[model samples]
Target chain A: MSIEIVNVSKRFGDFVALDSVSVSIPSGQLTALLGPSGGGKSTLLRIIAGLETADSGRIEIEGVDATKLSPQKRNVGFVFQHYAAFKHLSVARNVAFGLEIRKRPKDEIRERVHELLNLVHLSQFADRLPSQLSGGQRQRMALARALAVQPTVLLLDEPFGALDAKVRKELRDWLRRLHDEVHVTTVFVTHDQEEALEVADEIVVINEGRVEQIGSPDELYDSPANDFVMRFLGPVTELGDRLVRPHDLQLLTGGGEPDAVPGRITRITRVGFEIRVVVAVGEQLVTVTLTRNEFLSLGLQVGSEVQVRIAPEVGAVVGQPRLLGAV
Target chain B: MASHPSTRTRRGPVTYLVRLLVIAYLFLLVAWPVYLVGKNTFADGMDNINGILEDPDIVHAITLTVQVAIIAVIINTLFGVGISLLLVRYDFPGKRLLSALLDMPLSVSPIVVGLALVLVYGGRTGWFGPGLESMGFQVIFATPGIVLATVFVALPLVIREVVPVLEEVGEEQEQAARSLGANAWQTFRRITLPSIKWGVVYGVVLSLARSLGEFGAVKVVSGNVLGQTRTATLVVEEKYLNFDKGGAYATAFLLALVAVACIIIVSVIRPKEDR
Candidate 1:
């Protein structure tokens, strides 16, 4: 089921949590609400789930007005950042909770519970409490529990946020694969840009309780709607009036006169498969990335003077004034 | 492990002296009384205990105390869980004021609580007593009056114990249950209830102990009606007044035994909860 959050606004006393935030999430797609902390992405997700009520707007689920409906009638599965598994319940019973509350037959509940445990690869931990499992395992169990009800929509608030980096990556890939298999309308919130880029079909970047921009990962990176989205996704360099990514800038070996912009190299750092070269052009610092072979051929090093050239097709005019400086 | 010279110097004879003082204080205040009571009750070859058990008034007092304790526990558990949930989960105007009001029972003296209940529900002169009596209900100088006073005295114990656990567990699980098609009541039963089960147990046990041991409040409301209003504590006081030393010791021994049992249960349940 598609979720349409229209002009939704919520406030906590004097603080605004969401302000006229509207977004249309398509069915059967994994979307990510990507933003910094305190950006109201979680509030929007909670509003859609009916776990929170908006102060001044409406939400429609499957084209039906769902603003007044309680969360129980919304049929949306929510996985919290901190597992939220029932601490006193066995893993199996936790997964069976939704079905049990719906008054499903005992046999059906057991079957679904077993099926979910197997799906999350926690069959052996069926009898174990949530505290017995690792952070990643608990989140997996939480996911299984959320999916047990076969909800119309699935909402996950930083589902792998508490896990370490390695476990987080593994779960991200696993969640992507799981979404492919289940294909429920899924919306997950995270501040991790890499996670949103890797897993989501669409990324909704939020800032200060408003939607900065929403688009596919490549679309957001290549042609950001504004300076905030550009700076938020990855490194951006300003060239007079236009915005360009670090990768879009090319560095020539020779300090050519009159044709290329002359810049003094300040730092050269090798990061994984690419080499980053920070060059100073006047007061602005430009970052350029090159392949290992290209760096070797250019013989680029710190304290070296180089010529910088912005590619012809790389420039995208930033729609708004820069809200933040380049990081 | 290497011990720093500064740390070693910090732990002087004063620390050891303080530890000894605490030990001596506890031994004198708690252990000495318990030992004396145990020795006195069992002193005279069980004759005192047997006579106290055979007395109908004593037996009736024990039954009444147990009945009131059980009823108080049930009522407190329901309202305690509900009120604690309200305090922890929701934000509202005067929330701090309501929270402060919850501590009234804990701070106010039990005798004062009895007087307040009497003022509210005693007789035709009371605030609601005449209307209640017209509706065929008697509160003051009756079992209901005794229970009201006891409830007022013991009301804060359960709420105090349960609120911290509810705050620690948070509203995420309840929100998750709601999203999973569980209604408010279902969410409370499946998620909230289980998470706060140990807290509720500790609270109810505490309330039970307080209710059973209550004398000051029950004294004012019960009017010490023999066989009807005389609770276990009241019987002990009565036995003392009558100069029946053996009977008083035996009843006090029984009350102490039950209180000790409650402490033991709490200790057992607490360590498991920590895990």
Candidate 2:
């Protein structure tokens, strides 16, 4: 089901958690609400799920105004960040909670629980308590439980936040595949940009209780709506009169081109697949990334003379720099 | 990191001296008195026990005390769970004051609690006593009066036990259950109750112990009528004053044994609370 949020606002005493936030989530696509901490992304997600009430505005789920409806009536499933599994319940019972509450037939509930356990790849652990499982296993069980009742919308708040880095990467890919299989309209809040870029079909970037931009990963990376979006997506370097991304700058061994910005290399560091070169161009410092083959071709070292170039067609202009704090 | 048993450690002679002093103080104050009571009760062996057991008044007193304790524990468990839920889950005016008032039974002496109940529900001049008597029911100096006194003294145990557990568990699982289509009652029965079950058990144990051994308040309100309102402690007091030394010590020994059993049961069932 598609979700349409219009002019929603929320306040916690003196703090404004959401300010007229509006966004449309298309049906059957996984969307990520990405922002820094305290940016109100989680608040917006909770409001849409009906887990929290908005001070103003309406939420429509598939042409139905859901703002006045309770979370149960909205047919929305929510997975908490910490899993929140019942400690007294086994994995099978946890997954069967929603269906059991609906008073489904005993045989049907058992069958559905068995099916969900298999889908989450936890069939063997059906009889184990939540404490007996690892962090990733607990999260997967939480996902299966949320999906048991066949909700129209699935909302998750930092579902993989508590896991280690290696498990997080694994679960991200697993979640992407599971979403593809289920095809449920999903909205998840995340502070990690790489996770959002890799997993979401569309991203809604929020900052200070406002929508900064909404687009696909490539659209956000190539052409950001403002300096906030640009700096939020990745590192931005200031050249002479323009702001450009590190990947957009080119490094050269010889200063032949007239448009090239000449500088001396200060540091060369290999980070995964890309080699980063920090250069001192006059009084300004600029960073450029080159492929291993390109760096090998240049035969460059630290304190070597180099020239940087960003062709007119390749370099996208980001806004000028300002002091970084609340914004 | 390894050290021999004879090795000199960071802790000096003062630490050893302090530990020895604390152990001696507790043993002298607690263990010695308990030993004397046990020694006195069993001094004449089976003859002393048979003498107390043969007395019909002593048997009736023991039975009454057990019945009153059980009834008080049941009533308090229900109200205790309700009050704990209200205190931990919601915020409202006078919440702090309400919590403070729940502790009044603990701070006030049992005799004072009995007097307070009497002032509210005693003779025709008291607040509710006249209305209640006119309705063909009696409260003061009756079974109900004794029960009220015991309930008042045991009220705080269950509430104090359950509140901390409820606060620690939080509303996360309850919210999860709600979003999963469970209503308020279902959520409490399925999620909330099971989570706090251990705390309630611990509280009920304490309440049972307190209600069973209650003497001051029961004595003040019960009138100590023979075979009517006299509990085991009251019987023990009367027997001691009559110079029936064996009967008094035997009844007192029985109450102490029950209290010790309660402690053992509680320790056996206590969850390790991993944190």
Candidate 3:
């Protein structure tokens, strides 16, 4: 199901959790509400799930007004950051809860629970309590429980936030695969930009209770609407008056371009296949990234003077005057 | 390892002294007095206990006390769980005031609670007593009055136990259930109630103990009629005041036994829940 949120606003006392935010989530796509902590991404996801009410505006699910609908009536599956597993219930029972609530046939509930558990690769732990499972397994169980009801939309609030980094990456790939298989309208809230960039089909960048930008990962990284979107999506450094990616800043031993700025190499560090060179460009320290082959050929070291220039292609896209959006 | 040994030796004397003091304090304040009560109850080889059990009036008082206690516990459990959920899950005006007032029963004297109930429910001169009596329900000087007093005194026990657990467990699971298409009642039954089960059990056990042992409030509200309004605690007082020492001791022993049993049950249940 597609979800359309129109001019939604919310406040907690004097704190505005969401301004007049509007966004359209397409059907059968994995979309991410991405932002920093307390930036209202989770609140917007909750409002879409009917777990929270918007102060002023409308939510339409599949073109049906769902602003005042209860979460139960909205048929949106939600997964919480903490797993929110029913501690006393076994994994299978947790998965079967929604079906049981709807008074589904016992055999049907069992079959569906079995199917969901297998889908989430948790069939082996179906009878185990959630506490016995690892963080990743518990989150998978929560996902299975959410999907068992065949909800119109699957909404997740930082579903893998509590997991360790390795487990988070595994779940990220698993969620992407699951989305491909299930093809349900899925919206996940996350502050981790990498998670959003790596998994989501479309990304909605939210900040300070408003939508900053919305596009695919490539679109956002290549042509950010503003500085916030650029800085948030990936590592970007200010060169001259423009924000550019570290990898886009090229170093040359001899200056050729008029736009090239001279700087002295302050430090060089090797990470995996890339080398990071920090340059003291006037009062600012700017970092330039180089491939291993490129650094080995240059034989650059600390105290070496070099000229820094933005890559031509990247410069053509991001070298425009910075546009400052609403705070 | 060398530093640890030196620290341990230095702190050993003070630790032992504190342990000794606490043990001595508990033995004198609680263990010794309770042992004496048990000894006196069994002094005549269960004769006192057997005699009290055989007496119709005493038996009636004990039965009445059990009934009133069970009813009060039921009322308190329902009210306590409901109020705890409201306090933890919802926001409204006066929520803090309501939370503060829920603890009033714990801090206020039981006698004051009984008097307050009487002032509102006493048939002769109470605010609503006359009208209630006219409608064929007698609250004061009757079984209902005793129940009201017991319920009042034990009101906070369940809420006190359940509130922290409710807060700790949080509303996330409940919201998850709702998002899974569970209605309010289903969410409570399947999600909220199970997560808070241990808390509610602890609360119910405590409320039961408090209701069973209530004295001052019951004494104030109950008219102390020979067999009608008298409760077990009242029987203990009446027997002692009337020079029937053995009967009083026996009744007190039974009440003490229940309270101790409650404590034992809680301790046994606690470790399993913590796991």
Name the best candidate (by TM-score). 3
Question: Which lDDT tens digits does candidate 3 get at residues B79-123?
Answer: 999999898888899999998888898899998988999999998
For residues B5-46, write the lDDT of model 1, one tens digit per residue: 576558789989998999999999999998898898889989
Candidate 2, residue A183: CA error in Å?
0.8
lDDT of 1 at A213: 93
User: lDDT by residue for model 2 over A193-259, one digit each (tens)?
Assistant: 9999999999999999999999999899888888888888888887775678888888888768866
lDDT of 3 at B53: 96
User: Clashing residue pairs, candidate 1?
Assistant: none
Q: lDDT values of the candidates?
A: 0.88, 0.90, 0.90
Model 1 spans > 4 angstroms off? A253-259, A301-305, A315-327, B1-16, B269-271
The parts of candidate 2 lying over 4 Å away from their true place are A252-260, A299-301, A304-306, A320-327, B1-22, B270-275
User: For chain B alone, what TM-score does every candidate structure achieve against the true structure?
Assistant: 0.93, 0.92, 0.94
DockQ of each: 0.82, 0.75, 0.85
RMSD of each: 3.4, 3.8, 3.3
**Which 10-residue window of candidate 3 chain A scores lowest in summed lDDT?**
A318-327
Clashing pairs in 2: none
For candidate 1, write residues A202-235 as lDDT tens digits: 9999999999998999999888888888888987
